[model samples]
Target: MRHVDELADRARALLTPGSRRVLGIAGPPGAGKSTLAAAVVDALGGQAALVLMDGFHLADAELRRLGRADRKGAPDTFDAYGYGALLARLRAPRHGETVYAPSFERELEQPLAGALPVPPDVPLVVTEGNYLLLDEEPWSSAVRPLLDEVWWVAVDDTVRVERLVARHVRFGRTEAEARAWVLRSDEANARRAAPGRDRADVVVDLDSGRVTPSAAPA
Candidate 1:
C-alpha cells in the first residue's frame, strides 16, 4: 500500500539518461508484488515495461511429467534458468528490436509464449516474482546481478493467506481446495522466500502503505 508517487519516484531514479534499468519486485505469494509492480509501471507510463517470472512457469505437461503439478507454484516448478537467461537478454537488449517475454494465463493455467513485448526504447523494466532475491545457485548468479534494485513486499501473514485463498477460489478452486492449496503449497513457498526480505534494498509494508530501507532481519 505504499503511495504510488513514492514508488514512481524510486522507479524513475532507476532510469539512466540513455540506458535501460531493471527494477525487480520480490515477495512471496499473496504479498501483492504484481499489484505494486503494475502500479509502478502505470505511474511511469511508456518509460517502463513489465516481465513476470511467472511467465517462465513450466508448461503443465512438463510439470505433470515431472510429477510436480501438485506443487505447481513452488520454485522448482518454474524454468528458473530460462528466466535468468531472459533477464540477461533484457539487461542488454538489441537496438530497435522488441524483446518478447512469455506470460502466464490464469484461466488456462499455462504459460503463453511471447505474450509480452518489451520495446527497445523502454528505459525501465519492472519484473516481479517470489524468487528474485533467492541466494540459490543459478538464480543468485543469473538474476541478482542484472537488477538495478529490488524491493520486497511484505504483508501480514493472516491477510496474505486470506488474499491467497480468495485468489485461488476466484481462479476456479473450491473454497476448501483454495484454503488447502494456500496452506499446503503457498505457505511453504512463503517460508522459503522469507529470507529474501533481508536482502532487499527496500521493504514495502503493504498493510501500512509505507516503504523503508531494509535493515537487519526481523
Candidate 2:
C-alpha cells in the first residue's frame, strides 16, 4: 500500500492541469503490471484513468490469420498502430468530449471495444502491457514516443513463472500446458522486452518492494 501510495504521487506530479499525461507500465507476463496500474489509478481516484495496451491485442481470430497464435503475447501480435493512435487522441482529446478506449476481457480472451471512457479532464492516463518500451519496429516507432513516462515492472523469475502458470491454469489451460507456455512463449518474450528497461523512466521491482529510477541507457 505504501508503494502504491508513493507511485500514485509520482504519477500525479506528471499532471499539468489542462492536458492528459500518459504513464505507461510494461513488464513480462505475470509481473503484475495490471495490478499495479489498477492500484495507481485507484489511489489517484478521479484524477486518473486506465487504458490497458492489452486492449490492442490482435484478436485470436486475427492471430490465427497471421499464424501467430503460438506467439500470442509477442510484440507483433498487437495493433501497435492503433494503440499509438489511441494515445495520440488521449494526449490531446477534444474539449468537453470523452474518448473511449478499449479494454481486454481476460476471461473472454478478447478485447471489448469502447470499454473505458477517458474524460478530457482526467489529467493522467495509466496504460500497462508487455511491450510498451520494446525497441522494435512499429512498437518502437509508434508507441514509445506517445508515452510521457514508461515504468518497467518486474519480479523474480520463479515467482513470475509460478504466477503465470497459475494464471494460465485459471484461464483454462492444464497445469503442464501452463508451464510449457510460460517457459516457451512468455519467457522468450520477456527476454526480448527486458532490455527496454534501460530506457525506462522508472523501474518497479515487486519482489524487492522497490520503485527506483532506471539505469540510463549507455
TM-score of each: 0.96, 0.96
Runs in model 1 lying further than 4 Å from the true structure: 216-218
Pairs clashing within candidate 2: none
* Candidate 1, poorest ten consecutive residues by summed lDDT: 209-218
lDDT of each: 0.91, 0.91
Model 1 TM-score relative to the real fold: 0.96
Task: Work out how many backbone clashes candidate 2 has.
Answer: 0
In candidate 1, which residue pairs get closer than 3 Å at backbone N, Cα or C atoms, i.e. clash?
Answer: 1-209
For residues 1-218, write the lDDT of model 1, one tens digit per residue. Answer: 44989989988987898788999999999999999999999999999999999999999899999999999888889888899899889888789899999988988889999999999989899999999998887678888888989999999999999999999899999999999999999999999889999999999998888899877542
Tens-digit lDDT string for candidate 2 (125-182):
9999889889888999899999999999978989999999999899999999999999
Once fitted onto the true fold, the runs of candidate 2 whose alpha carbons sit more than 4 angstroms away are: none
Query: Candidate 2 versus the native: TM-score?
Result: 0.96
